[model samples]
Target: MIREQATDKRTLKTIRYDADLIVVGGGLSGVCCAITAARAGTRVVLVQDRPVLGGNSSSEVRLWVLGATSHMGNNNRWAREGGVIDELLLENLYRNPEGNPLILDTILLEKVVMEANISLLLNTAVYEVEKSDEETISGIKAFCSQNSTLYDLVAPLFCDASGDGIVGFQAGAAFRMGAESREEFDEKFAPTAEYGELLGHSLYFYTKDTGRPVRFVPPAYALDDITKIPRYKRFNAQEYGCQLWWIEYGGRLDTVHDTEAIKWELWKVVYGVWNYIKNSGQFPEAETMTLEWVGQIPGKRESRRFEGDYILKQQDVVEQRTHPDAIAFGGWSIDLHPADGIFSEKPGCNQWHSKGIYQIPYRCLYSRNVTNLFLAGRIISASHVAFGSSRVMGTGAHVAQAVGMAAALSARHHLLPRDLTEPARMQTLQQELLKTGQHIPGITLHDDQDIAQTAQLSASSEFILTELPPDGPLLPLTFSAAQMLPLPAGPIPQLTAFVTADRDTTLTVELRKSSKPFNHTPDVTLETKTLSIHKGKQEVDLTFDSHIDEPQYVFITFLKNEHIQLQYSQLRVTGILSVFNKINPAVSNYGKQEPTEDIGVDTFEFWCPERRPAGQNMALRIATGIQLFSPANSLNGIQRPTNQPNAWVSERNDPNPALTLTWPTKQRISRVELSFDSDFDHPLESVIMIHPETVSPFCVDEFVLCNDRQERIFHKTDNHQSRSTIRFAQPVETSSLTIHLKTNHEKAPAALMEVRCYSVS
Candidate 1:
C-alpha cells in the first residue's frame, strides 16, 4: 500500500483517525452508506462538506425523497429495506408535522448521531484523495472548518457517493458523461448518438411567511424578453416559485464547464422571474411570501458515471429484469431533462418503460478499471437511459446501502466485490440483506419446519380482532382497560365483518376505551392478542354487519403484561365509518370565568373481534382529553373561531396526556373513529385524546378525513395538539376513545367527538 507523507506546509492537521470505511460525501447516498456499514459492524467515518446532511432533499433544496414504495406508488421488489430508512420516515412523520425543512434536517441529523459505529464530520470537505497507484484508494484528505486543518482518513474501501463522482474521476477511473448516441445503448430517448449536451443545473429556493408584504424584484440577469420562448407561455404560479425556475441555461456557455457561472446566472434568473411576476401583477399574493432559501450550490442532476463490470442498459429496465447478482432496485421512470438549452413540453420529456420495476446488478456498482474503488448512488455505471430512471436520491440511497453491505461482506470474507457475483455468494448476500429487513424479490427464508403452515389473511378486511397470545416471546400480552374475548372453536375468529367496496383494504387492531362517563377510578381492562396472517394475501371475512356505518373508526386494545416492545410487518383497515362532527358551541358563556374546574371524564370504545389469522399480532394503548372553549380568552383555553377550524389554538396552563402502542410489523389500520357522550355540547373544538397506533414511535403513515357528506378536510396540528393532544388526527370514528384509561398526567384527558359546530347536512 502506498502512503502519503504528511508535509509541514500542508496547513491541514489530522484531527481524528481510525475507521473501517470512510464515506466521502454526506449526501443521502453517503449517509446511507455510512449507516449501513456501521450497522453491519464496520466503523464508519462520514465526512460531509455542508453543515447539514440529506444533500438535495434537505431544507436547502426543499425536495421530497421519493421512492418506489407504496407511498409513492412504484411498489418495486426492493421496497423492503426498513432499518434506517424506516426510522427516517418515522422521524419525518413526527418532526415534519407540517412537512417543513427544519424538521427534515433534524431527522437526518438524528440518524447520524444515533448510530453507535458512525463518526460524523460536518463542515468538512474532502479536497484531495490518497490512492495506492491507480487501482486502490488508501485515504482521503479532509479539511475541518473549525480549526482550518486537514485530516487523513485511512480505510480499506471508499465509496464515491459524491454526485459529481469526484473521487473516481480523481483516481483515474474510466467514466462518461452526457449521452452516447441511440446507437450505443439503443435508447429511444437519446439525442442523436455521440456525446451530446447534458442536463442543466438549478438553484432551488424556499418561501417563508413574512407578516408584512414584500414585492418581488428582478435580478440583474432576468431575461425579460421571453417573447422568443414559447415555454414561457406555459409557465404559471403553480410551476414557478420564487426559488425554483429553470429560466437561464446555456447563457454562460456549457453548464458542466462553467458550473459556477451557470449557478450565478440561475440565481439571477430566479430573482428576475419573481420580479416579472410581481411587477406584472400576475399574482396578488406574491407579496405575502418572502424568499426563505436560495441555493448556494446548483443541484446537478446529471454528471459522470464511472464505468463498472456491467453497464446497465435500457433493455434490462424494459424487460423487468432480474439478476442473480442484483444488489439494488430502482423504479422511477426514465426522466430525461432537456440538454439542448430548450425546454420541451412534450409528454415524453420523461420516458417510461413498459415494466416499472428494474434491477441494478452489483457489477455496475463498482469500478471496472479501479481494482478496489467502488461507486454507488447516481455515479454508478449505467447507460444514459438507465441512469435517467435510477438517478432519484431515494433510489440512490437504497443502492448505497446495498453497496455498503457488499463492501462490508467483502472485507470480512477477504474477497473482492467481483467475487461475490457468483450465484452462491450472491445468495449469501441476499440472505444477509433479508435478515436485516432488506427486501429482495422472489426471496424468502424459512425459520420453521413447515412451509405450508403460514397464516393467510386478506388486505381488504374491515377489521381483525383476536385475543392476546397466551404464551410465547414472539407475541406478548398486555392487560389494560379493554377486555379480551377468547377465540371461538374455529380455525379463525368468528367475527362478522364485510365491505361494500372490493378495493384493497387494511385491518388494524387497537386497544380502545368504551363510550362512557369519565370517573376518577379505572373502570376498563383489556388483554393483548396475537393474530397471524400471510405476507401479501388478505383473508376473506367470516361475515358482514350492514348496520355499521361506512368509514367507521374501529378501536381495540392489547394489554401489555410486561413492558414488551412489539413491531408489526403490515397493517390495514377498511370499511370503517369515518365521522366528523362540527359542533359549534357558545364559548362566550365561559369568557370571563376563571375556567371550569377539572370536569368529569368521558369514554369511547370499540371491540376487537376475537378471531384473526394465527401468528398475526397487534399493539394497543389510549389517549384522552376534551377541547375546552373560551372565546375572548386565548390565555385560559384552547380556542378556534366559529367560522374557521384551521386557525391556531392557545393552551393556557393545562396540558393533555398521550399513550403510545407499538406493534411488530409495518401494517395499515382498517378503521378509526372518535367517541363522545351525550353530555358533550356542540361547537365541538379540538380532538382531546386519540389512540391510533399510527401516532406511536414506529409507524409514520399519513391520515386523511372524509365526512358523511363525502367532503374531505385536511387536518393541521397546533401547539395545543403538539403538547396536549394524543394523536394529531382522528382515525375514522368517535366511539373508540372511551374504553382506554384516563391518566391525570397533565397531558391525558377524555376524547372529544368534534370541535366545529356545523353538521354535515
Candidate 2:
C-alpha cells in the first residue's frame, strides 16, 4: 500500500502566501537560485514536486555532485569561482565525514532551513502559470500533495530553474527542443540536420562491502550478452556500490506521455542488472555486500530549452567568446549523444567540442518574448550541441546564481531582466557577483610578483609552533600572528604542518588547514587529531623517572580550534617504544591487567608536515617498533598475587597492538628513522623519549601532533608528550607555531618536553 500524507482539500484554499520571488524547481539550480535570492534579502519560495531537494544528486537519483574540474581533471575552474557553492563544499568537508547521501541531505536541509528569507515547500508541483497577456507572468498555481489542495503564489519575479523550463513554456515564452542543423550555428558538433529528440536519462544505485562470504542471484529476464556493456565493464562490482545501470532514452516518443513506461523499464533494467551480478557469482562476497539504496527518480539529462533574447551557440563555446553581459561559464566539451534513441547509434555517436570552457552570455537566461520570467539550469537557450556542454549541474548552479541575482536586482530596481543587460547595469551585477565569490573573467586582478615572492618566502621559512589549552573550557587558538598572504599572481601558496600526539582524546577542528584573516573569530576549526606515534630518536621517546604507588598512562595531543587559520599538507608519525608496569615488583603484586585495558602504555602521537605549492612534492618516511604475540596465550600472562583482589589479566601475551598507516606516496623525501626503549617493561618511570634522526633543517608553516583523532588539529600543552619534533626541508619565514592537545582521558596524562622551530642552514 502507498501510505502518503493525509490530505485536507478544503483548508488549503485560504492560506496566506508571501514571497518576492518564486523559484519553481528544487534541483541544484533552483536551490542555488532560491538561496542566492534569499541571501540577498528577497523573500523566496522554493517549490519541488519531490519530498527532497537536489534533484539528480539526492537519494532519488544518487548521482554524485561532479564539479567542473576535480582531482581527475583540470576543468574544475568553476569551483574556483566560489560563492554559496564554496560554502557548501566547506560545509560538506566537515558534516559529511564519509561523504554519503544521508549526510548530503542533512546539508541541503540545513542550508534551506537556516536561511530566514527562504521558505521551501516540498511535495508541491507547479501546474500552471497565471500571466498577464503573453509577456508577463503574474503568479503560479501549485498543487500540494500533502494537503491535496491548490495554492496561488504571487511574485514580482519568477525563475524557471526547472530543467524543463516549465514556467517559460506555460507563460507563452518561445522555446526550442532537440537539435539544430549544423548550418544554424556553424557548430562543428551539431547534427548534419535538425532533429526533435533529446538525450536519455539514468537510474543509479548504492552498495557496500561486508568483508564476508556471500552469493549472487540473477534476475529471470537478465540477458548475458547485452547486460555486459563494454562501456561500463571497467567498474568492479566488488569495490564500488553505486552503478549507473538504468540508462534509457526519452522525449522523442512524447516525454510527458512516455515517462511512466520509461520509469518502469528503467526499474526492470536496474533489477535485472543487479540479479545478473548476484547470480553470476562473479563476486563471491556479493551476498554479503548489500545494496544500500536505489534511486527513487530517473535523472533527466535533457529537456526543452526556452528561447532567450540571446541564443548561446556552439560558436560561443568554441571561440571562447566573452560576452559584455556574460553571467556564467561552461567547460565541458560539446558532447551530443544520439537524439534518435539510446543504443540507436553507439553512445556519443554525434559529439564534438572546442576543447575548453567559454563565456555564456546573460541574455540566454531570460525569455526573449516574456518579461517577468527567467530560465536557468538545463533549459537555458542553447543549441543542442552547446547545451550538451553547459547542461552539467555545476554550470547550471552558476547559471542559477546569475538568474537569481538578476531577478533580485530587477525587483529591487523595479526593472526587468532586459533592462539589467545594459552595460552599466550589467557591470554592476558583475561587481556584485565577484564580491560574493562568483567567478567572472576580467575580475580577479592581483600582482603576480608578490604572489611568487610570498610562495618562495613561505617555502623557505622555519616552522612556528603554538600550544593550546587541553582541559575544562576549550578556547580558540592561533598559529601565525601575521595576516593571510595576499592572492599571488601564480598558483596559490599553501601552509603545511606535521602533528604528533602522546595520548588519546577527542578534538574538534576544521578541514582547511590554511585560512584567511578575520575580524573577530571564526567558529570552525580546520583539523582534528587521530591516533598516536612512538619511534626511536626520530619519532618519540618518553622516560618517566618518578616512582608511584599506582601505575598511570601517559598522553599527548595537538588541536586546531576556531582562532587558528591554517591548511594541512601532510601527517607522519612512528610508534617505536611503549613502557608499562608489568615488570615492576610492586605492581606485580596486583592481578594482571585486562587485555582490553591499557597496560600502562596508553600513549598516542602523529606528525603534521608542511604544505607546499600545488605542483611541488615533499618526501617523508615513517617507521615503527613492533612487539607481537598470540592472542590466546597473551591472556595467560595476566598474573595476580595472593593479596591483590582487583588484579586483571595482561594483554602482553596477545602480541602488541595492531597499527595501520597511510600517507601520500607520490612525494619525494629523505629517509625516516625510529628507535625503541629497552626498559619499556619496567614500572614507576618518569618519562620515555622517541627521537628522530638528525638531518638538514627546513621551515614549516605550522605543526600539530596529538593522540586523539578529534584533538589532532587543536593542540594543548597540558597533554604534552615527552618527545616530539617539527622538521623542515629548508628554513621558512614564519615565526611561531600553535599546538593543540587533548586532556579528556583520566588514565593517560600527556606531557610535552620542548617546542622548537629551527633553521636548516
Candidate 3:
C-alpha cells in the first residue's frame, strides 16, 4: 500500500504557483536575484533546471567562482562584487579555503531554504511561456523530470537569469549572439567582419593521491598524439580542479543549442588528456595518483545577450564610462577569446584592460521589447565585446542583485519592470541595496530613516587591539610585487609589518598617495624609508611623521629582494583595500612607460601570484600603538570591512560599556538592528563556510535597552549570526536611548558591528 501510494504520487500532476516575481535559473545570478527579492518582502519562485545551485561553480561543472576582481587580475585593484555576492564570497573564503565545490553547493541551498519568501523548485526546467501580449509575459510552464510534475508559474515580473536567456527567447525578446563587427560598436578589438561565433565550453577533472601506487590504462578513444595540443606540455596528473579551464571545445557551433555535442567533445578531450598524463610515462609522480572526479556538464562561456533599453558597448567599457543610472560596477578587463577556442593558432584569448572600474547602468537589466521581462547574468543587455567582461560570474551576480531590488520595488508599486525608469523609484531601489551593504560607485547612502547618522557616537574606552589572529596564512612577499595599504584619517609616527628575510638586507619602503579615493594606484610619493632588516621573525618599523586629513590609499612598495617576505592577513575591513604591483617587461600606459603615469596603472594587466580571495587585507599594523578602532565607525555609513578592520571594541576589564543614541526631540522608534563582529574574517555569502564553526566569543551575550525613561531587557542565548533585528511590540517615544551590553563567554573587549534604529510604520 505504501509503495502504491508513492507510485501514485509520482504520477504527473499539474500545479499552479503565483508569485510576485519568477526567477528562472539557479546560478549565482539567479540565486542572488531570488534571495534579494525574497528578503525585500517579495514572493519569489526560483526555478532551477539542475539539482545544485551554483551553476558552473557547482560540483557538476567545478568552475571557480570569479567576479570583477578577475582573480585579482591587473587594473582591478580593490574591486569586488557587492550585495549578495559579497556574502557568498566571504563565506566561501572562511569555510572552504580549499575551494571545495560540494561544500559550496550546501551553502547556496541553505541560503535559499532560510529565506521565508522564496519557493525553490529544483530539477525543474521551464519549456513554455504564456504571453499576454506582444510585450508582456504572463506566465511559464516548467516540467520536473524527477517528480514527473508540470508547474504553471505566474508572476507580474520575470527575470531571465538563465545563462542562455531561455525565457526571453520564448517570449520573443530581441537578443544578440556571437561576435559583432568593429564598425558596428566602434570597438577596436572587435572582429573586422561580423560573425555569430562564440567562446566555447570547458570540462574540468580532479585527481587524488591514493595511499599506495595506482595504475591506469588508456581506452581506445583516447588521443594517441598529445603533442597536437599546445598546452599538453603543462599537463600533469596532479593538475586538477579549474586549472584545466583552458581545456575547452565547441566554439565553432552554438554554445547553448549544441550544448550536448560540445559536452561530448569536451569529454573526449578530458579522457585524452588524462590518458597522456597517466600512460605517457613522462611523469613518475602519477604512479600513485588516480582520477578522482571529472565534470559531466561543460561550463558554457557565451550565449544569448538580450536587448534592453541600453546595450553596453566595448567603448563604454574601454573608456570607463559612468552611467547616470549606474547600479553596479565591474573592473575586469575586456577579455575576448577566439571562436576557435583550443584549436585556434592564436593565444587562448586577448584582453584589453580598462582605465578603472566602469559602471553598469540600470537600463541594461530589463528588456525593451518584452515589457515585463528583466534580464540578469550573462543574458543582460550588452554588445558581444562588452559581454566578454560582464559575463564573469561575479559581475553577473551584481547585475542580478540590481534586478532583484528593482523587481521588489516594482511589485510594491504595482508597476511594470520598466517603471523603474523614474528617478524616484530607482533611488529607492539603490538605497535599499546600500542598506544591505552593496556599494555602488558614484553613489552615497543618505537615507534619512537611519537614526545612526543623527547620533553623536561615544564609547567607554578606546584601546589598541594587537592580539588579533592573522587574517589567514601569511604569503611570501616577492620582489616583483608591491602592496598598497589604506590608511585612516589621523597622524602617525611609524608603520610596522611582520617580515622574514633569508639573509640580512636593507628593505626600501615608499609611501605614495592617489588623488581619487575610489582609485587603486598611488600617484605622489609622500615619503621614503630604508630599514636595515634582520634574517628571521623580524618586526620591521619604518618611522615617519605624517597626517592624513581624510581616508586615503597609501601605496607602499617594498623593492623586490629574493630573500625577503612580508606578512599578510586575510581579514577584510571597510575603507581599506590591499593591492600589489608586479614587474612587467613590456609596458606602456597612457602613451609612456618611463617615469610612468599613475593613470596608466589602470591599463596594465595585473595578475595576482595566488588567488586573492575577496575581502582580504594586508597584515600591516600601526607601530604607534594608539587605538584607532572607534565606536563612531559603526555610524560612518561604511558597512564593508577592509584591512583597517572597522567596528568598535571595548577595552579589556572595562566596566559598564554602553553605546547611547540621543535626539534633541522625541522620535518614535519601532525597531533596532544590531550587527555583531562574529569574526569579521568569516564573511557571509550565499553559501556558508564550514570552518570556524564556533561563534565568536567577542559577541555580546546580554544587553539592556533604555529609551529615556522606558527600559527593556533582551538576552542573547547564542552569538552566531552577523546581523540581528529586534522589533519592539510597540513604538517607543524617547529623546535618548542607551544599549548596555556584556560580552559573551566571559570574553572581554566586546565588539559590535553597527546599531541601526528604524521607525517602520
Candidate 4:
C-alpha cells in the first residue's frame, strides 16, 4: 500500500451515530444512566472523556461510592439507593471484594459494552453542541484522542452528567455555581463566604508494602516542606486513598475551566504528603511502603449546578418533604468542605444529617431552559446545601437512573422532558422506576398491568415474630442497643430479653418510635419500664403499657449498661434487625447530635445497625406473635421494607418454603418479576472497604418456579441481586403459579418482597 500526499485541507475521520438518547460523561451517574436507558429499549450513545468509565470511582480517581446509606452512620434504616447502582455494587463485591480499582473499571466498561443498545465512546470529549432550533440540542461533536476520530452524535433526548454541566452550559441552560445565601432558601446551615461557598476537589493515592526498604526521592515539583499542611501530623501509612479525603483544594478558582490548575495543586499536596510519610522520620513501619498509585485527576465536588423547574433546597432535605413527582431519594448529610481545603484552619468538613430519607422530585432532574436536556449527577437542580448531600456517586447514579428511564419514556411517547411533569405521566414514570427496582421514598408500586393482583396468594408457612432464641454468643453492651419492631396501632407487646449482668443493677427499658411512620429514628418515647437485675444471667420481661396511633417501627431500647452482656441470635430474618446507639465520626455523629445553634438541622439520637456478621438481632421472646409477615405481602406492590416489614418471610425451619398464587381462570404470562431482600441497608462502598459477605444473608440464593401442572418453568441459582426479572421464551398459560425459595444462609429465613406477573414481555 502506498500513502497519498497530504492535501491542503485535512480533517479527521468523522463518524456519525444516530441514537434515541445521548449521555455525556462516564461517571457512575452517566454509566448508570446509559445502562438504564439502553435496558429500557432506547438506543443510546454514551460519551466519556476518560480512558475508562466511572469518573471518580475509576482507578484514576479512586473515591468510594456512597449515598443514602451514609456509611451506616445515621438512622436511615434499609436506606441504600437501589436500581442500577445496587447491581453495580453487588457485582463489584462478587468480583472484586478487595476493591481493586482496575476491576471496577472493567465492571463499568463491561456493563456498558454488554448493553447492545448502547454505543460507548471512551476517551471521547464533547467539545461542541449543536442546537436544533433555539432551546433543543440536536447533536453533539466529540473527538477521541486515542483513535484520532471525530464523532457527531445525534439524539432527541440528552442527559448531561458531565460533572460541570458541559452540555447544559453549551445549550444555554440556566445554572448556578456558587452557594446560595441563607435568605435565598431559609437554610441556616448555609456556609458563609468566610467558611466556603463551594465544596472543593479531592485527590487520592494508594500505598503498598514492598516487603523491603524502598527509598522514595521527592521530585522537583513535590513540596519539600510538609509542615505547611495543617493536618500533616495526622497522616499515616494506613490513611491513604479515600481515607485522606480531606486532601482537597481549589474552591476559590473556577472548578470547570481551571480544573488543570486544581489537579496540579492536588498532585502537589498528594506527593508532598507521601514525601512526609516516607522521609519525615515519623513512622518506622512506612519504611517498606511505596506509593502504589496517585490520582491523575482531581475528583470534583461542586461546579455549575443546572437549573430545573424546581430547585431542591435545604428544607426539602431537612424537613423530609415529599414531592408529588418524586422519582428517587437521598439520605447523605448536607456535607460541605471548607474553602481553604487542605490549608484551611477550620475543620475538614461540616455535616448535618436528617432523621430520614427525603424524596427527589422529577422536576429537579431536567433543565428549565434547555427543553431537551436532562440534568443529572452533581448538576441537578439543588441548592448548594442540598447539593452537598446529593452529590455523592450513588445518589447521583440513582438520579441519573431516573433520567435514563425518563429518556426511554420520552422516546416512546415523543414528548419533551418538561411534558413528563404532568400528573399522569409522573405516576407512570414513578411506576416504571419502581418496576426497575428503583426505590422512591413513601411510594408504593401499584402497577395496573400486573395480573398477579387478581390471584390468591398462599404460603407454606408465614413468619411470625415469636422469638429469637438465645442460641448464639453473648456480647457485651458497648453501646445502647435496641431491637427494632414493626407494630400495629395497638397496645405494645411484652418482650423478654436474656442478659448476663456482672453486678446487680437496675435496667431501664424504654419503648420509642419515630414521629413519622417510615422513619426509623426513635425520637418519641412511648413507654418506659425499669427492671431489677441480678448478677447472674436471667430473662427480663419488658411489659410496657404503651399504645400507638398508627402502625410504625418501635424501638425496644435497652439503655447502655457496660456490666451487662446481651445474648444475640444468629437467626437472621429479612426486614428485622437490632440497632445500636453509637458514633460514626465520618458523618459528624458523636453518640447523639445536639447542635448548639439553630443550623437548620435536627438534634436527635443516631440508632444505626452494625454491619453483618456482627449486627445480629438481640435474643428476645414476644408475648404474642406479631401477625405482620403475611403471604399477601408479596402482592402489596412494595419491594423494600418501609413503615413495616413489607416482605413475606418464611417461618424458621420450614422444610419447604414456598408461595402459591391461584387464579380462577388460566392466563398467558410471558414475564415475571421477583424481588427479594438483599439487605438494602448496606452501603456496599465500591472502593477500599472490604465486606464480610458478597451476598446478603437475607438474599434468596436459589429459587424455582412451577406452573399449574407442577412443571418447573424456571429456576435461578447463585442469586444475589434484589430484583430478578424472568422472561419466558414461550408464553406459559397456567391457572396457578408457585415459587419455591431456598435460603442462602442457615441464619436467614426465606423471604420474598414482591412477585409480579405480566402478560407482556
**Which candidate should be chosen as best, given lDDT against the real structure?**
4
Better of 1 and 4 by lDDT: 4
TM-score list, all predictions: 0.59, 0.58, 0.81, 0.99
Q: Summarize candidate 1's per-residue lDDT along 1-761 as a digit string, tens digits.
A: 98989877754456757777778788888988888888788888888888888887676655556554312222121142333454465445444545566667887888888899888888888878878776788888888787687788887877888888778888889998767676776665565322245666666665565878876665657766654344655444444321233443542245456888877766665665556555666666666766666767776677788899999887776555678787666665555655533333332133342223557788898899877777878899988878877787767887888877887887787777677888888877776664444444435433232111121211111112231222212332332222222121122223321112123333333322211111101123322234433333233222212221121112333333333323321221111111111111111111011213311111222121211222222322111121222111111111211111111122312232111222232223233222111110110000111112223211112222333322333332311121111232434322111112122222112222222111111
Q: How many steric clashes between backbone atoms does each model show?
A: 117, 128, 15, 0
Estimate, for each residue in 509-599, the C-alpha lDDT of model 2 and write its tens digit: 2222111121001112333334233321122222222221222111111243333222221211111111111111111111121223321
Q: In model 4, where do residues sit more than 4 Å from their true spots?
A: none
Go through the candidates in order and give each one's C-alpha lDDT: 0.49, 0.49, 0.72, 0.91
Off by over 4 Å in 3: 1-12, 73-78, 92-98, 191-196, 463-509, 523-551, 561-579, 582-602, 605-630, 641-658, 663-670, 674-753
Which 10-residue span in candidate 1 carries the lowest summed lDDT?
678-687
Q: In angstroms, give how far residue 441 of model 4 lies from its true place.
A: 1.0
Q: Tens digit of lDDT per residue, candidate 4, span 240-317? A: 789889998988888888889999888888888888888888888999999988888889999999899999999999
